[model samples]
Target: MSRNPRILVTGATGRLGRLLVPRLLARGAHVRALTREAGRAASLAADGAEVVVGDLGDGASLRHAFHGASHLFLLSPISPELAAEQIAAIAAAKAAGVQRIVKLSGSHWTIEPPGRSLSGDAHAHIEAALRASGIAHQVLRPNAWLQVTLARLAGELAAGDVLHAPPAFPKVAGIDARDIADVAAHALLGPEPSATDSPWVLTGARAVDHHEIARIASALSGRRIVAEPLSREALAQRAAQAESPYVAQVHAQFAALIGTGEAATVTDTVERVLGRPARTIEAFVAEALAA
Candidate 1:
């Protein structure tokens, strides 16, 4: 409850947690980072945060990770067993006297009325667990990440080939992952804002149709890459042919959501939280392409 609480961050070796740890330390929070690999601890230690080797499934390791920490950052990625993993982490945080939790949730997924989709269903279960755990917390449902487009299509784009997957007509707002981190950091470290308990639908200040994203990507790279729309079945087939298992699953999920037009809506949570306009798709593409 005091300023600069001891914070335990799960998934310290991950994209979001790795970025979050440094920011938390900058705010003077004593951070204990949890990573499955002992080798990864050096990086966190180098940054002046305590690193504990642990897994979300291993209760003993989690207990060690949360010892003396007053706040927990929970970001258990979606998988076949996400609900169990999140529940374990939440239980450990509650038992260890952790004061608050900041859960990283899916953007367009919802299960309030009991949807059959895995993401929606799983996220809802996890949220219910967090609520039941009785921990003071904030839930951030960030919009579809703009960075995934680069990461997922890097090989295809690098070869100057068209990304033949979903339709370019679907309207989806792309939010930068950095903005998500900024909001999470503010919630964890800033003076407790009045809406900390509320669910924040974080999104870019503006929405960009997929067609525009494809056009901008082509312009930035000097190559014409068409975003070919495909049927749900065709998209699944394409994902199955991809080299990375992660990308394959993601494409399949996005294809389904886009088909249903679930991801087309936009929100202004980023502006509401950070008091500034969020980054645009063009800016994201330009920076990523340059990188």
Candidate 2:
């Protein structure tokens, strides 16, 4: 019998990472999870993952985590240093003799006229670096996360019927993070690397506008939810109130992309890889609310 691959999973405490770890465990892959905080990794350790305390910025820590691992699932938190962090991780994986790396990249990262989206530009740079490294790699570029939208607007959805946000013009086929995790698990544990170097664009079953989202929210929450389009300035003000100015700026840029209909494209990558339909936004909202 062939032995299961030893996989090193970065961002193991993150939204997708948390889900992917258990799925990998279920598949009988030997999983090692890297996290900065050992305290936060206790639950993953309990779930049979070999948790390693490591910082993506710290070369020594990442080298230690990558040691003896045959495969790697590379994901890092969004930050100004995202590109640097991922590149460092890739270098560490290569030095440790990891055979393959499945990186969680971003949708529209390959879009022309680069640097349009800060996050997309960073991911593109990392992808380029990965290609230069000559490592066997596959990239999964998921669209706007339904979980992020739901979490950001949870309070508004619960308190009132109005779902206020910037205009949704181009529409978005928002994907569930859990589906991304499922796909990542398959990529890490699959018998062979992807046939091509082209990144896979993962999306939900269909594109949806805010109106559709409001309707779904209403049905799920048993309340009349209305889509309220806010001005860019208004959206920025709200984001600033909730988070940092940088976050507000990023959100504004994303809103502009959505307004221009640039983010509405859907793809069959998820179903093609997993042999099952991607989870719907309605289902994600329902599960999140229940939890």
* Highest TM-score scorer: 2
Best by lDDT: 2
Off by over 4 Å in 2: 109-113, 152-154, 168-170, 219-223, 231-234, 241-247, 288-291
Q: Which stretches of candidate 1 lie over 4 Å from their true place?
A: 110-113, 153-158, 161-165, 193-196, 218-226, 229-238, 241-254
Candidate 2 lDDT over residue span 54-101, tens digit each: 999999898899989999899987677789999999999889888889
lDDT of 2 at 109: 32
**What is each predicted model's overall lDDT from 0 to 1?**
0.75, 0.82
Against the true structure, candidate 1 reaches a TM-score of 0.86
As for candidate 2, its clashing pairs are: 170-261
> Against the hidden reference, what TM-scores do the models get?
0.86, 0.90
- Find the number of clashing residue pairs for candidate 2: 1
